[model samples]
Target chain A: MTTMKDIAKVLGLNESTVSRALNNHPYVRPETREKVMEAARRMNYRPNTLARSLATSRSYVVGLVISNIANLFFAEVTKGIEEVADAHGYSVILCDTGRNPAKELKYLDLLARRQVDGIIFMSGRLPAHVVAAIKQQSCPVVTISRDGTRHGIPTVRINNRAEAAKATRYLINLGHRRIGFISGQLDDAESGLPRLEGYRAALEESGIEFDPAIVQEGDFRMESGMRACARIMQAAPRPTAIFAANDEMAIGAMKTLSQLGFKVPADVAVIGFDDTAFATVVTPPLTTIAQPLRMLGTSAMEMLLKLMAGQRLAEIETVLECQLVVRASCGGTGL
Target chain B: MTTMKDIAKVLGLNESTVSRALNNHPYVRPETREKVMEAARRMNYRPNTLARSLATSRSYVVGLVISNIANLFFAEVTKGIEEVADAHGYSVILCDTGRNPAKELKYLDLLARRQVDGIIFMSGRLPAHVVAAIKQQSCPVVTISRDGTRHGIPTVRINNRAEAAKATRYLINLGHRRIGFISGQLDDAESGLPRLEGYRAALEESGIEFDPAIVQEGDFRMESGMRACARIMQAAPRPTAIFAANDEMAIGAMKTLSQLGFKVPADVAVIGFDDTAFATVVTPPLTTIAQPLRMLGTSAMEMLLKLMAGQRLAEIETVLECQLVVRASCGGTGL
Candidate 1:
């Protein structure tokens, strides 16, 4: 509770001198600063951070909006973001939108009002106009795991199309002539469109006709995938292999296939994206496309910090690669 | 950027009247309040949250100090906290200490500086003195998954000892006499001592002699379980059953034992605490104790909010029960 006045009275110096010393103003003598610091530490003095923030216009805090913390993918990415943010003396305010855009917008408003230095948007489908309004507030906003290039916001993401294509090609090379695709909800902004496009491109390149009947839309939930798989299986001459946009969906599909008396790989091979923790634990394991999730988070934080410091970012889009981890689910080996 | 002065000028009123009306003060006429609100909205006026915070001393934000988000148990618990916090119009700032008390202290300092209205400490070994120091700052601190009753801070946690005893008793009823125990990190505030105590209590009730050599310490990690399982396996008259404090350790032990050519339930039975997602997916499907993780999160937030509202809190502890989920891992019929 010690203020500048108390320090000044104790040191027999004017309040202005005490304030300058405490603020580390260059005008204050080094000797004065040393005496003031020693006295402050001795008295167990703590500065009024709220009052200081009002004057400095900096809270040294960043806002991170994620869909769900329980999702291992998001958790890993958050770890990456935390490391980068903490190293720079910045803390993150976490807002879980629960995949609700309205909630995401509400948090955005709250973060803006709180005057966060920057924001890292991870997952969730935030409306374009809402993002624009945030940018208009003059705070740096970096979008992660989603391509926000059209909005001109700095974005860090994986090459979803390329990774999807690679996964599809791998399936094709395994002698699967007919392939079914399970797509995530198109409204998810980052997950659905590019991956679906990649799936199409792979089929086109291989001289195979794109069959709309074989593709089912899923909301990225396990239940959605379960139902989608059931529908795909009921289709005439069901595809020999299935590619899900994410591991959760792929696992759901695998579970459904198992219940329906289909032997994975021997009957219908399965592959998933995101290489989440469940990717390895599911029966027959799972072959997955691994997004550099941690790197994506790290890059997002780094880019946001750079922008906050008034540095020009080299590119609006930062893309990392994905790896294909082949396991038993793709008709490979043990769990 | 429109301020009260701008609104006042447009409304032909004093800044004080505009401010009062905008704040919805009862003294202001309802008509005036409506006019002020309409003008503010039309002008896209956003209040300076930092300045308002300085005056009101309420940031409408809470701080969450967690050990790690990658742990599925913690992640689920966090999700519950988010649900309640968001509903109550409070944002949560997340600080992951990565199980380091020094880092936890640093984050506590940061949270204090940020002026979060309250804090929820989740599964971290924070010294009591640290909790006292935090409480001294006049911020409501609620420790979840850790005992903070003596520190006068509200706590929300499952009855770990009772849950552990139940899990052990279940194994005992299954005709297993020789059971090995894997203890979580001793430093981990919750889950360690209480779980071990519960394990011992169950053995005592069954009139079984406590075997110190059969107990192994694990850091609540899968790799640690693997090492501990190896050590236990080499013991004279190896245990026919193993109980891990958590699912990760249980799965690790199962994987190691299986690799060593032991058939689960037939050669060695395993049970884990915290029925995480992996518990069901792993081969032999782990039978474990299930904590109401999400409810714990919600209750913690509610308690913190109540404390922040100046309500006199009743006894600072809120203990929930845990359920024992039977699965193939515990030598139970999958049916």
Candidate 2:
């Protein structure tokens, strides 16, 4: 195994000089660094990163705990996080919890043991135990798409309430007096309740009565959306439009409407949230809320990097905006 | 910083015993391990895994270099890899290359520096420089979905040629004469050329003239599939059935057919490879070849694990089976 010492000997440079150049220290001259790197490559010198990290107390690795990777939303966000981490000479260790608390705890413990410099956490909901565990680990953490400020953690997210209301208002503008809403799981306070509340708020603002009978709860899954839409459509004077808290459910609702022999945007219009990859591919190209998914990831990672550097955060909560993307499902030009 | 020695002293146990308990050494009694764990939790002892790894010359970490995570196929495979790695007390460091050779080489170097136990590599095409770099790194490697046996590396893959021929034959059995084929990038010999050859072989077997005019090359992306489909459809004699090398391109072709006002099977039947999530969500859910994506990840990881353990492989290449999933796009019952 070739080492920095061997590279130094080959380059005829001092060991300390070779070490600084290998570590990319700014104090080293560019030409010196290049020569050292060339020698290291030629000698097949492999640096002992673990040892160096231990001595410096910095691993240059970050832990990313994502709820699920199969979900396109999280996948795209991960891409953004990876891009930023790579650009900054950092490696990311991804732990996909698959919404399992036990696995989440296990990964958190493992990451702490590995001594990752910081962590970026994304979950549908932050449980109390998990929050306590994170605090106990003493690792800098930045939450994405969830408001972690209440727990004294920095967060990057969009205003779910405002965006949900915007989507609702768009439906009301389409003259949908009897609009049905499929909400996310009630336990998801960061996204579900706010979205449902936004729907009610929109109805109130438009002088339309909020009928609890027309709303159903979905678990933020496509099948749940399908079931909720079926139930919502069974109400007397069925809804003229359906607004789902997420795109998966919206697409599900569209599928149900088709099965029920109703034409989209003619007999019933649908609007979804999250504008994921599924948004454009689904039939009629779903009208949805487009969140800057990648931006959310980059922002959270950036915040975590700053926190890891011991920099005081200027803001605890960084909220991005969400836009309503008009498409054929909502009887829009879909341009 | 609660050290193992401190925990051992407080628990009235030998430091070696405490270390063995914390490390899950097989020789340690279960009760002793439990007692040490309880004390470690009470004392908030975070183990320095880096130091232990260095002493043992083992990191208990593996590198997974995937082409893309946003591709549902790879994401599902990653889930499988993570599940198995987590179960075996191993950590996976995912490097999504996005098909860039420069990034691929950089990640390989980083993984080598990090001293990962092994690597599970997935790529559309493994270039010569990359193969040479892996050879130089002296790291155990197992490839997924690509044959690396020629380069003295173990591989886990499906028979792309056989599966592609099966899909073509299925279309032929459905009474299609003028069939169009969309291939992956020409340089991807493992997946693209074989599939194209399979299509050609099927045509020859069925006594149908293989017309080059109706075949087009796609980059295994949705937009490229659309472009290929448009070009294929413009052939003097429009094809009655179109087969894509992958699902994304297939869905793209579906969208193109819809835009051209052609009903799925009634006008031009469509078949795709890799029954990804999009296969089910698209309008007229796609008929595709199910490649056991998750199984691919698990198998590759298992092979890499065996190699890392210095175990001899019984087979150089592991080939899994592929099944033709008939769905609405192929005008089948879709059950």
Per-model TM values vs. the true structure: 0.90, 0.94
Chain B TM-score for all candidates, comma-separated? 0.91, 0.92
Predictions in order: chain A TM-score: 0.90, 0.93
The global C-alpha lDDT for each of the candidates, from Candidate 1 onward, is 0.85, 0.89
Superposed on the true interface residues, model 2 gives a C-alpha RMSD in angstroms of 1.0
lDDT of 2 by residue, A194-273 (tens): 99999999999999999988899998888898899999999999999999999999988888898899999899999999
Candidate 1 regions exceeding 4 Å error are A126-129, A174-178, A186-189, A208-215, A227-241, A257-269, A331-335, B128-132, B174-178, B186-189, B208-215, B230-241, B257-269, B283-285, B327-335
**Lowest lDDT 10-residue stretch of candidate 2 chain B:** B326-335
Q: How large is the i-RMS for each model, in angstroms?
A: 2.0, 1.0
Best by lDDT: 2
Q: Model 1, residue B78: displacement in angstroms?
A: 2.3
Give every collision pair in model 2.
none
DockQ result, candidate 2: 0.71
Model 2, TM vs. native: 0.94
* Candidate 2 lDDT over residue span B104-199, tens digit each: 898898998898888888864677888887777766988887758788878999999999999999999998999999999878889989999999
